[model samples]
Target: MNAARGGGSVENGIANFAPLAATVFLALVMLLPVGTGVANVMMPHFVLIATFYWLLRRPVLMPYGACAAIGFLLDLWLDVPLGLNMLMLLSTRLFILSQIKYLRGQTRLVQWLVFALFTLILYTLSWFAVALAKRDWLPVEPLFTQWLVTTLSYAPVALVIGRLRRVMV
Candidate 1:
């Protein structure tokens, strides 16, 4: 009985981290080499995509603490201002968590619209924050490209996250 209990505990531990593993994998994939080309000019924010996806799908699994930790790591890894990603991610989590009730049973189009709106807000906030921190207005082109690319990439990324959710949940 003790051996059986130990085996179950090990399984539970792995299960608990399944969501984190998947999101972290997606985050790493976002950093893959895409070469110096026009295609790589604008990269989608996969971490944001995955965070929003998991929070919406399984809020119980991806708590605010996990989201904050992921965002903090991203800030450190990317050498951005401390807490910038943390602020953004925590804000996103709060917004979605609060709205989960209304979001339930919604049509796909509605869900996508919500995601698009949040993505736009998230990008805008990042751009504004950077400008404020640097005390200079940055060029609009890069931020625009990133926002566009991320908004467009949402469908595919969300679809992949949905599949992963099935396995993890």
Candidate 2:
């Protein structure tokens, strides 16, 4: 019976690991579309936001190594400047990781407040960097639109992820 229990535990550990891998894989896949020859409109960075949540929620699982890997993938797949996403991701992770204490069991208002500021900062920084890197004299109109959509959508997604964790637990 003990051996059976041990074997089951091992199997379950392997099973649990699958989804984590899938999430990382999907994150990479999401960035790849921008690199292809097909014309694509710029969308808000989903993987960055999702990775931010996972890092804050479970830092042990989403360490700097994972974030760096994801950032490198973003650089390659999105054709963004090398180290642009890496720097953005690292700074953002550090900022969010610092606020994890306030996020625990917080009110919805608090979460929205935090995410709103963070998203604005992220979008603005990316906008500035892209404008510099690509040498495009584009305006900030689309940047704000993307920020609006991302901020409006990110909270609900994080909440759903939280709820899913509860159900699983």
Q: Which model scores highest in TM-score?
A: 1
Mark the regions of model 2 whose C-alpha exceeds 4 Å error after superposition.
1-8, 15-22, 25-42, 167-169
What's the residue-level lDDT of 86 in candidate 2? 75
**Total backbone collisions, model 1:** 0
User: In model 1, what is the error at residue 163, expressed in angstroms?
Assistant: 1.4
lDDT per residue (tens digit) for residues 1-169 in model 2: 7557655565555544433564465566465545345765555566666766666666666667767777787788778788877777777778878878878678767767787788788778888898898898669888888788777767776776666545544
Candidate 1 residue pairs in backbone clash: none
Pairs that clash in candidate 2: none
lDDT of 2: 0.70
TM-score of 2: 0.75
